[model samples]
Target: MSFATPLYLCGPLREPRQMLADQQYSGHTSIHDDSMAEKLGFRAGPIEGPTHFSLFVPLLAEIWGQAWFERGCFSSHFQNMVVEGELVRAFVERPAPGTTRVRAWAEKADGTPVLEASASLGPDDGATLLDERMAKLRAPEKLVILSGLYVGMLGAEDEKVRMDAEQHMGDLYPFSLAQKLEGITENSPWYSDAASTPWGRAVIPLEMVSVLAEYTSKQAAFPVKQPVIGLFADQEIRMIDGPLFVGEDYLIRREIVALSESKRTESYWVRSRIYDASGETLKAEMLLNHATLKHSYADYEAEASA
Candidate 1:
């Protein structure tokens, strides 16, 4: 809870780029676009939250070593939106000599908090940041944008997904792995040189792993009110038998695990399981909280009043 010093580790300040300015979803420009963000009340398009995950890799890796890539988990709750050109740095609390979990956070140079998180190495069984958040969730008194969604709902199909260096990730992402690497906050040969990594394959960057899982998310068809703006409220990514590799075949299956609401938004929690091409070997998992802004739905008021 406290982020005071002796900071176990701190990353260099970095200006993460806004690669999602051109991103589109639900047949409209997403909140990551400057125009859409302004219309939605944000000063400018904010860089995707996960883009900052790369900044913590070096710091975490230093603590857990190669095991960090194989079985580490990062669970986060977004605290503030960050636009391009803002300087941000990552920090990790120094853990007791044998503790598996530690507090982590990112902050802008001006002292505004960006996110608060928990980082841990496997085989960890303790509560993560999202675990704590999910535990305290109160069911919504009403549902509008996400009325049709419910817990335990499964994806429409088993999606076969893969990330290749040059393969564009579709409208939602609007970029390729190669393009992301060009401006990545951190870099390593393991991301590009197959022969250079201990796994003997090119591994996808931490942030790109988020992109890969979401690349074909639409195909899952967990129907909700359309054209509503949403943003990630909380997230957790766990590497099971990972570092997921580039140019490798993988399959993803999604399920709606929970739904809740706030004064201004309705949220649905989705858990995605990534597996080997055969769908038998579990590789990684991602749990995302997508919070849809109530005002963005054209009929939110009308439906509520009715």
Candidate 2:
């Protein structure tokens, strides 16, 4: 692919209401749940991190082509959260030719940073943003929510996950793509129409990819018994063999990568590998930092005080 070609000459497109998935799991009112978010001081539950990822698809496809879906890596560190109906836009500051990576970011019209990321097509594309971050991650200390999880802890067994056409996404993601789009603040055709592209089927949006790649997390429960609510502190999705088509089956294996803590929460990193149904060809991967709020776990307070 040529370097100078502009994916969006018109500049960033307005990203509209993206809040959809309701994370009612822990009942503590996470940013994913509207009522919970409002009570927690946010305007409304802020849109999920993975949902913001969809903003970059068109730009990636424009710069990398179909090959990108096979081996592209998008690594990001979330900077801030925006609630439903907030105006934001994705931008790619394309790299000068002969370079392997480019900087990407999203900002509200008022210029608040949303998330900053790096995108590249590779295995040879060099290290992704998450790769570098993971390399520097310090082992977590004095953890309560993620107490038993150690590096390299494996899942109980391999998991096979897929998205059904009827909007059923299985346990990890209770809502389907159709349902998500219903209240979608940003309406994009690329998410629903297969005929819009040369690909025979509709493309799976990153929001769906988030579910497609890790819906079976419970099968590999890492022994963290705390009922504390968890959220993605940071996440990276890397595609190896394809774009991860909709309604296709993929197998995944998870391992605890690292554990770390912040002032208010403790986090565990899980590295999940996605494979085609044949179980041989690797297709995609996700690196997730599941950060649990210490304030939400009563046990954490007791342990800290003791």
Please list the C-alpha lDDT of all candidates, in the order they appear: 0.92, 0.74
- Which portions of model 1 miss their true places by more than 4 Å? 1-6
lDDT tens per residue, model 2, 279-303? 8988888898888878777677788
Candidate 1, residue 281: CA error in Å?
A: 1.4
lDDT at 290 for candidate 1?
95
lDDT score of residue 11 within candidate 2: 37
Measured by C-alpha RMSD in angstroms, how accurate is candidate 1?
A: 2.5
lDDT of 1 by residue, 100-162 (tens): 889999999998999999999877648899999999999888898888988999999999999
Reference-based lDDT, residue 153, model 2: 92
Candidate 1 residue pairs in clash (backbone atoms < 3 Å): none
Candidate 2, RMSD to the unseen true structure: 3.4
